[model samples]
Target: MPLTPIKSDDPVHLAMQGLFPDYNPACLEPAQDLELLRGMLRPRSSGGVKGLVHRSFQGVTRRCPRPLRELLLGLAHRLRCADPELLKEPNQCEFNRLVAGVRSQGSRQRGYAGKRAALCLSYDVDLLSCYRFLPTLLDQLDQRGLKATFHLLTDWEYRLDPALVEEVSARGHEVGLHGASHDVALGYRRDERIAGELRRALRGLGKNVHSYRAPALCMTERLMARVRDLGFRIDSSLPMSSMFHPSTQSCFPYPLEPSGVLWELPILLQDSTLFLDLGLSQEQAWSFVETHLKQVLELGGVGVINLHPSWAAKYSGFHGRLLDAAREWSDFAVMTHKEVYNCCRWGGAAPSAPAC
Candidate 1:
């Protein structure tokens, strides 16, 4: 008689079931098993008093006396390490499995043969300052022969310049909706209102808008359903970090399940969280990005990097160096979000569509 194969009942396996309900357990390899173990053993966020301590310590560690600061930083780091919200690597095994599923689907649909890994550069144009640096950012990308996606905030406090939005599209870059406003609570908005606002914003962006990213990475299932209803094909609002929201599960693109219409390309690295929140120096932040990129490539996953134009302008030299490094890094294909979505959704040859 043939031996029965074991179906895991472990929490990690259960979580994976929730994330990729269609995935085959037989696809679970030794490496992925190890990754799941690591994820399980890692620290998780406890959103009560422990979370408060983590936040408070993180806030004042820099200002403490040198020796005290060292102690505080160390303690905070340990606490954060335990925060289940954080991930050692953005592309966990389960998420990678889903990516594999998409790749397989694409191959079947269109016989798609593309790079094993992809690096997507994305910008959240929420601040007015972003517009000021847009020209230079575009120029840098052009010089390097790189493509990026710029997600624009349409109904923010400062009126959006349609000309600037058009310029982004006119160039070879992709444009995506960043939300009607930079509201932190945008995700919690009533469904009808959310749909109305998003629809209006999409209309303003014209026909090229196929992607969206919620303001501040604040997204809920209801919000995603609204996004799909509004006709956006892809969303990049999910982050690998649980610090933003507890439900963020993957760093790879997966159909927003149940609805199964919209694809979510999670942010693998976010500049604001690294620089503003974690207080990493420019060099340190870039170093983290390089490490994450290398890890993503090693795992054969997509690395979606979110860099804000406002922050880039503040550290132009650093941003320039990072772009230069990305250009030099040839191990993975660098693509715009739209191109990746096309391949993921329709299974065609990697698009060589004009960036504009």
Candidate 2:
């Protein structure tokens, strides 16, 4: 579908236009209005008195003593968000709006080989608990004759089991990399620091690990450039979920530079955000996933299902059902990140939409 032009010289409109290049405001059964949809897709930024306070608060927080920053603040969030029941106080109404936002944002295009929509089940193996749940996850995928990408942790709190990595790869799954701990600083650090950390992580895992996603989706151009130079074929660092407040980046795949050699694979609806950060109930979380995913499928775009192994094990009843449902989706192909990359790169996919 051709993008409907917003024929206006207004700077505001131009910025929004940039955000939604192939803009097609979907008119669903109930007829969601254009303005309503625009509101949903709008990129919010802080301004005025409140913006000043926000900046001040952030500055003060950053200036805090190292001990307080490392232990009292950063470490607290790291542990808390990983806990199943401990929430970061998310807004339920915002979540509902996000679910609704999917309905009106319209179809996205790129890199899929056929008319059938694409699905990629990606797991972030961050915790020891997440590592423990791998066997069961592998069995489920095997039973369903499906494959997924499992990104192992490196330079995190502990190391991932090399044996487990071999097992996953042997079963026709992808072994990707999650660079460091959930600290968001990986992106903003100096170039040499980031490069050194990445080199250390890729030392021996480089050959097998072709996909990389940053911890907590923390990324910058320098960071990604380093990743691409390090030999990662795909980077799933930008998260797509309206609940991410002002940054509701859609999870539509596109080629990253060095002229499309490396792909940008964005994931929508991460389990860590739902189960650990927001602490939504299993039913609520799964419902949100199913609703938005079906819409994306109908739009003929790739829907990346991101599950943290720790959370999946915590709510196996729901996660298991999700796996079973994948087989029933006769309309789509569930693939690993590497598989998607291959299809788009070599399997005659249409030219992808501009990078998100």
Candidate 3:
């Protein structure tokens, strides 16, 4: 008299199967279905899913819609009743092959991509040590046949001898903005204040300021939007390290929401993070950089190294070791953040930049 429950293989079951085709109704009991339905009514967790589900959900979230999100939350609950051995055991050959296929494709981009690296030689102009070391650092870069983007603070430029700015530009280096003043709590400041700081920094550097890295490596979504509004093309504050990596997927070098004009190039490694955050010796730090750079280069991906002028001056032979290590790798084009963004392909943007 009553309609029969559909089998997982039945056509009717396809509508509720969600993302994966192998998901089967046979794997779930009637009690599991009731539990899943109940979970659907609960609010989504603020921190998102937990544990292995967190890893599983990353792939799922990128493409999931609001309705699909609810469906997935429910589906996950039902899926838990699946055979423990099936879930816990290493994937079968077909699944492993599928994973390998995706990984190989993702990695292939890094390998034929050309070798390019950007050395951002920056000064938080407010720092007195930076003033002393910047000139020396510029000379060193000249000898090494390298150039950098100098993100300067406007108000503090007077502290450095005036000729130094011209000398840096003369030697083929770039001067951009740090901020008008180095606010100790810059990131925690209000949005308008931050924008004002950027404007003041730009005004001090003269109008040629087009690229920016945040003071203290602190950037919020609002700050990024303000940067775009100000006509800057790139943001270099994104962290490439595991601990400080951007909290959201949007931080990766790609198109933005509003203008689609701004590009975010994450700093793969910074000198300070090695010296201060990790308390690693320069040699130890160089080892980490070498390993990461080799991996990225072998895969054909962008490798960015941010070196502070102060550190290079303080640590004897550190800068030389960094340059020597770079010489061992092949097919890398080292440029500034602005150069990379202008040349890098984002969405429809053409990759006109050369392999320098």
Best by TM-score: 1
Model 2 residue 250 CA deviation (Å) reads 2.5
Q: Number of clashing residue pairs in every model?
A: 11, 0, 12
Error of 1 at 245 (Å): 2.1
> Local error of candidate 2 at 85, Å?
22
User: How well does candidate 2 score on lDDT at residue 290?
Assistant: 83
Query: Per-residue alpha-carbon lDDT of model 1 for 98-141, expressed as tens digits?
Result: 44554454322121126666888999887666867788888889
Q: Sort the candidates on lDDT, descending order.
A: 1, 2, 3
For 1-356, candidate 3 gives per-residue lDDT tens digits of 23235543322132222112233344333433433322221112222233234445535643555456547645644554323222111122221222233334332221113443333333444455677777777766677777677777666434544577777678877666677654424544568986787776665565565567776565655666677778777666655443433321111243333233665555566676667655678789777777766654433345557776667777657677876555434466656665565555342244432211
lDDT of every model, 2 decimals: 0.64, 0.62, 0.51
RMSD of each: 8.7, 8.2, 16.3
Off by over 4 Å in 3: 1-103, 106-126, 156-162, 242-252, 345-356
TM-score of each: 0.71, 0.68, 0.62
Model 2 per-residue lDDT tens digits across residues 328-351: 887778888887877766565433
Best by lDDT: 1
Native-to-model Cα distance after best TM-score fit, residue 192 in candidate 2, in Å: 1.0
| Residue-level lDDT for 159 in candidate 2 | 63
